[model samples]
Target chain A: MLKIIKPGLLTTVQDLGRTGYRHHGVVSSGAMDRNAHRIANWLVGNNESNATLEMTLMGPIIEVQEDALVAITGADLSPTIFGKPIANNRPIFLKKGSIIHFDRMKRGCRAYLAIGGGINVPKVMNSRSTDLRAKLGGYHGRSLVAEDILYIRKYSEHTKHTISHLRNQANQIDDFYQADWSVGRVSKIDNTYPIRVMKGRQFDWFTKESQASLVNKQFRITAASNRMGYRLDGNKLSQLKSQEMISEAVRFGTVQVPSDGNPIVLMADSQTTGGYPKIAEVATVDLSRLAQKKPGDMIDFTWITHKEAEQLLIKQEREMKQLLVGVQLRSYR
Target chain B: MEYKLSPMGDQSILIELGNTIDLATHDIVQHVVTCLDSMDHAWIIEYIPAFTSITVIYDPVQVLEIEANPFKSPYHIVANIIEEQIQQIAVLETKKQRTIEIPVLYGGEYGPDISIVAEHNHLTIEEVISFHTAGEYTVYMIGFAPGFPYIGGLPKRIATPRKTTPRSVTPARSVGIAGEQTGVYSIESPGGWQVIGRTPLELFQPNDPEPTLLQTGDKIKFKSVTKEVYDHLEAKLC
Candidate 1:
């Protein structure tokens, strides 16, 4: 169990998100940075889809009610246990009554905290993820607040083993003990790598100049951005010919251009259907990178073929499977 | 109707059945969705059917293996499978659809924009209500919010553009019109649609096995009722 002392910013339990609900207009609200969430869960020997706390820009101060093995992944929120700084992307054991506090963010916009046992929240529509706008799922279907107590589920076999190992090492450190070795998070911090996109169904609606500007110019993430979508401030994309469009199915990573010309990249909690013209869709492999971008962060897009995007996705999935196996092998030692 | 298939990232594909929103195109879209649903492919996760399109969300790794030994790209492979499915449904039979009659109260505080909608179409408030109730609307899609159905078949004479300044809180069950489409607000949300009436039915309930009262292929008909009847139904629902 864990108790929230200070809910610094928006914090909610998220998994892989709600699936099979878009047909009824339900948005699949989950972790913005899926890579980070998976890594955090895996490091603590939990399933990749296990619910983890998704902490934004700022993070909450949690009081550990029991000795547990846990990990912090994604953004480096300068986390400390009982006044001692802890590392990210590695499993650490927190003693009972130890308070975990997240201070200044070194990089990235979101973080994931995964305990050995997953967060036990009632699943709605076959998912434990929270959809804030719909006000459903997760911890009361909303963000975490101070004084809220979160329960942890029964630990898996691997988590039990890790917990025992962590207990043995607790005496080595004052408050907590992090494992010597660490696995790299799925997403890497590489601003040099451009965000890849594919032409959308209405790609030809935009003029040649707008098409060129979309790829060449940099767009700044505006403050209006949220889980719903990222409102990008960039060169106004003017259409060659404008026409009213029928509302159609839209998904995560869809880049929609509204009447105002600003591009809004639909995120995890985006509406299932939209009438706005979609110019491009962010590549699945690049979506995790986009999730790490904070407000005012400038980003550029590069066009990629459909085949390339699929290949990248396949490659990432293969690597993730390998990472899980590698971690499992290490646990035996 | 001719359809075009486009890739929406690696996990999903967008199938545009037609360019315009009409009954024929909507039926075709729904037909394709039904066909895909029966396929029961392991990799296929969900199908999102809209006015004139269906987006298939699937697992690339799972679907890419059936065609080849060395695992090729899933984009063209999935598209090919979908095209094959569409071809098999050439002699598609029209599926059974439900016609849900929604009881509504027109022109009251619950419907603040009813007068403006009637004025825009140059019709009396009674005529506006009659026109809306006369036509049987086809549910094109459920989107924007949970269980918010975008229904077609509004009388062309009563069609009006959406409000320029959207309301911050349009109450739930508010019947609204935007261009050629009309729908009910399943939940309280900020929207631009010109509202003309309010329904007494609870369109959505989260805990229910089938949360939404209406589905994509369902038919809808509005029945005008007195405020007394509306109150009775609303109170019963509460």
Candidate 2:
């Protein structure tokens, strides 16, 4: 169990997200940087879909009420346990009375903390992810506030084993101890990397010049961006045809070009259907990189083939699976 | 009966049924979605049906597991499988479509744009309400917000352009129209649609087993109610 000491910025409970409800217009609201979220869970030996705390920009100061194993992944929030700096991307044991505080965000936009047993949140539509727009899921369908209590889910075999292993190796110098190894920096992506995109449903609707500009120009993330979509301030993409389009299904990373010409990339909390022309779609693997980008951050898009995007996603998933196995083996050791 | 299947991303594909947004095009979209729902493929995560297209989201990892080693991209593989399966049931018998009647109060504070719609169409407020209630609208899709149905079949006479600057906060259950499309705001959201009426029944209730009252391929009819009846239903909603 844990209690929120000071809820910073926008801290909410999120999982892999709800599925089988897009047809009903429910958005798949989840951790923006899924790569980071998964790593946090893997480090703590939790299921990949286990609910974790997604701290955006700033982070909350939490009081640990139970001795448990946890991992902090994504954004460098300068986290400290009782004034001692804690390592990210590795499993660490937290004493019952330990207090966790995040001073400032050094890098990235959002951070994730995964408890070994996950978080106890009501699963609306088969997910614990918070959809702020609809106020449907998560803790009371909103962000965490001061003094809010959070309970852990029933411990899994992996979690119980990991906790016992860490406690057995406890040291006299410190009550908390981090795992020997961690998710390496090789897996940690940089926001500066060119986001790869594929041609969308209405890619041909845009003029050739507009298409060229889309790939060549650097777009600054607008301040109006949120989980729903990222509004880009870049070269205005004009379409060759002015015909009104029928509303169609849109998903996360869909780059919609409205009448204003500036592109808007739909994110995790975006509406399911869109009427605007979709000029391009961010590649699945590159979505994590895009997700970490903050307002005013510059981003460049590079076109990739549909086949290439699929291969890249498969490769990332394979690496994550391998990492999970390695973490499980470490817990046993 | 021509359709195009295009990859939206690594995990999803957009199957375009036709060029237009008419009943015939929606029929194809409905047929494909109904067919896939019966398949119950574990790899298929969700399906979003629209006016003339359907987006099929699949778990690439699950697809890879289903297909043994050395397969082409999962996106291509899943698309091929879906294409093949949907083709078989493209000409299926029409299923019993669900029809929902939404009780609405036309004009006054609940429908501020009612006068605007009447003026734009060069018709009396009474005529606008009569025409809107007379036609049966087909639920083309549910989107924009949770359970917000995009209904078609609005009479051409009463069609009006959206407000230039959208209202900051349109109350939930506001029945509005923009151009040829008509929809209800299932939740309170900023919108540009010209609202002509407001429904008493909740179109979207998260607590309900089926949150959305309407679904894709359903039918909708607006039944006008007196202000007294509207007040009674509104009071009951709370």
Candidate 3:
């Protein structure tokens, strides 16, 4: 069991998210940075779909109630135990009564923490992801608060083996111990790299100038952003002609321009259907990078062919599988 | 049935069945959705059916595992499968449509915005209620919020514009009208629609096997009920 000493800005349990419910207007809410979420789970010897605690800019102060193996990934929030810093993207063994806390704003906006056996939460609509709008799933369908107690699911054979291996090497250390080796950067989160996008279904509906500006102009993430969407402030993109549109299906990374002309990139918690005009859709490979961005951060978009985007995603998935194998082999050693 | 397929993203394909929202377009959308549903491919994560289009979301990784073709992108591979399946689809045999009767308590405390709707149409409160109940409505889609049915066929006489400033908290089960379309809020949410009544029946049941009470292509009818009947039904059903 783990207890929340201080529930930072926002923290919620998430997995890969729910499917087969969007037909009923359900939103697929999950971790913003899925690559990091999967890495955290792999490091702890848990299934990729296991629920992990997703902490926002500010991370929670947690107290371990039992000995457990865990991993922290994604945006480095400067996690520490006993005033000593801990490494990211590697397996960590924590002793009972150990208090873990994150102190400063570091590389990314969100961090994922995965335990050996994963967080135990009743799945709603086939997912443990917190959907703040619908108020379902996750821990009571809400963010963690101070004094919240989280239980761990039963550990698998792999997890048990990994824990024992780490314990054998922790004789000289106290409170916590992390692996010497760590997974290298999965994807670039730095804003210097432009996020790739594909033309939307209604790309031709916008004026040529507006279409060019979409890729050429740099947009600043506004303060109004949330799990639902990132409202961008930049050149107002206007359509060639206004058309009456009925609500249609939308998904994460869909860049929709409303009547106000500001493009809002729909996130994991966005509604299933929207009536706005879609100008572009961010490439799936770069969604993790976009998820790591904070408000007021400047970002530029670049055009990519649909085929290229698919190839990029396929390549990333292969790399993730290789990483999983590498972690498993290291656990045996 | 002619359709155009486009990419919503790398993972989703948007198949536009028609250009307008009408019975013909709705039929094509339903036919395509039924075809996709029956296939049930492992790569297909889920499909969301809207007014005139259906967005089919698929897993690229899963597609690669099943298909050995390395040159073809996952989108193309899945799109090809969909194109092949949909082309062989025969003209849809009309299935029995399910019509759900929603009991509503219109006006007074239950509906604060009924007056706005009545004044906009220059009709009396009673006239608004009669006209609303007289028209037969069809569920075009279930969207915006969970189990929130987008019912069409509203009487033109009672159609009104949405509220200038939306209600921060539109009570659950509130039947609202925005433009020519009308719907019930399955959950408490911020909305811009003009609410005219409240229903006692719960549309969204998260614990149920079939969580949403309404489905796309279902028909809907509103029947006026007294406060006592509403109370009795609310107590018995809820």
lDDT of 2 by residue, A30-126 (tens): 9898989988998887888999999988889999999988999888899998788998888898878889998668888889999988999888988
- Write down the C-alpha DockQ for each prediction: 0.80, 0.79, 0.86
Clashing pairs in 1: none
CAPRI-wise, candidate 2 is medium
Clashing pairs in 2: none
Query: What digit string (tens of lDDT, one per residue) describes model 3 on residues B1-238?
Result: 7988888989999888988889889988888877887886788999999999999999988998988687888888888999998898877854568888999999988899999999999999999999999988988898888998888899999999898999899999999899988889999999999989999999998878999999999988899999999999999996
Clash counts for all predictions: 0, 0, 0
Q: Score every model by TM-score.
A: 0.96, 0.95, 0.98
lDDT tens per residue, model 3, A21-75: 9999999999999999999999999999999999999989999999999999999
Q: How displaced is residue A155 in candidate 1, in Å?
A: 1.1
List the candidates ranked by lDDT, beginning with the highest. Answer: 3, 1, 2
Quick one: RMSD of model 3? Answer: 1.4
Show model 1 residue runs off by greater than 4 Å.
A185-187, B66-71
Model 3, TM vs. native: 0.98
Docking class of 1: high
Query: Which residue pairs show backbone clashes in model 3?
Result: none
For candidate 2 chain B, the 10 contiguous residues with the lowest summed lDDT are B86-95
